[model samples]
Target: MGAVTSSMAAKFAFFPPTPPSYTLEEDEETGKLAMSGVPRRENVDVVRIKTKRATDVVAVYIKNPSASLSVLYSHGNAADLAQLYELFSQLSIHLGVNVMGEAPMLPYIVVRQVK
Candidate 1:
């Protein structure tokens, strides 16, 4: 039973999804992280929210969110903001609704010592 369990776990342990490629550069003057390669819309505001777990995540919020329902978009494990930024911007414009899209957080891995 132990061997079977270990084998099963091993299959998924290292087989995480491949995330999209993006570059984040901090401005030397403003000290703000510049998002490179992501499409930008005129009205949408890029903001960062800190989670209760002490992690910060990036989000794009359409203008005047109080007037409409917002979409809390969570990208798939294998994807990142760079790949979906354009899609989110289009959705907000075409759908005529406020859209808030968030980047995926890093997965938390737990290591156990097998005696």
Candidate 2:
């Protein structure tokens, strides 16, 4: 039974032996790492949110944020901020709303209960 279940789980699992794409490296000058391979835009603000867990959540905010609406983007596991930077920027401009995109991570669901 265990063997059969293990085989079934492996057949349906989405784990990859290696990273799907994108490589992260530290900058030689600043020794800071950022998502590369995408065009970096100016005038974007970096906002960090501190969680109760003591982890800092980082996001990028486009210039001239809208007063009415905003978007909090959580990218898929196989993607990163570098890849979606342009799309988010365009969305902010086209939708006329501020966009906050969080970096992608291991696949998991985020459920926030309303008060």
> CA lDDT, every prediction?
0.60, 0.56
Q: Give all TM-scores, in the order shown.
A: 0.58, 0.50
lDDT of 2: 0.56
Give the RMSD in angstroms, all C-alphas superposed, for model 2.
Answer: 10.2
The regions of model 2 sitting more than 4 angstroms off are: 1-35, 65-67, 75-79, 104-115
Lowest-sum lDDT 10-residue window in model 1? 106-115
Residue ranges of candidate 1 with Cα displaced over 4 Å: 1-19, 27-33, 64-67, 105-115
- Write the residue-wise lDDT of candidate 2 on 1-115 in tens digits: 9999999986667343244233444446654434435554664654445668766554566664454788888643333555567888888889888887865332331222222
Report the number of backbone clashes for model 1: 0
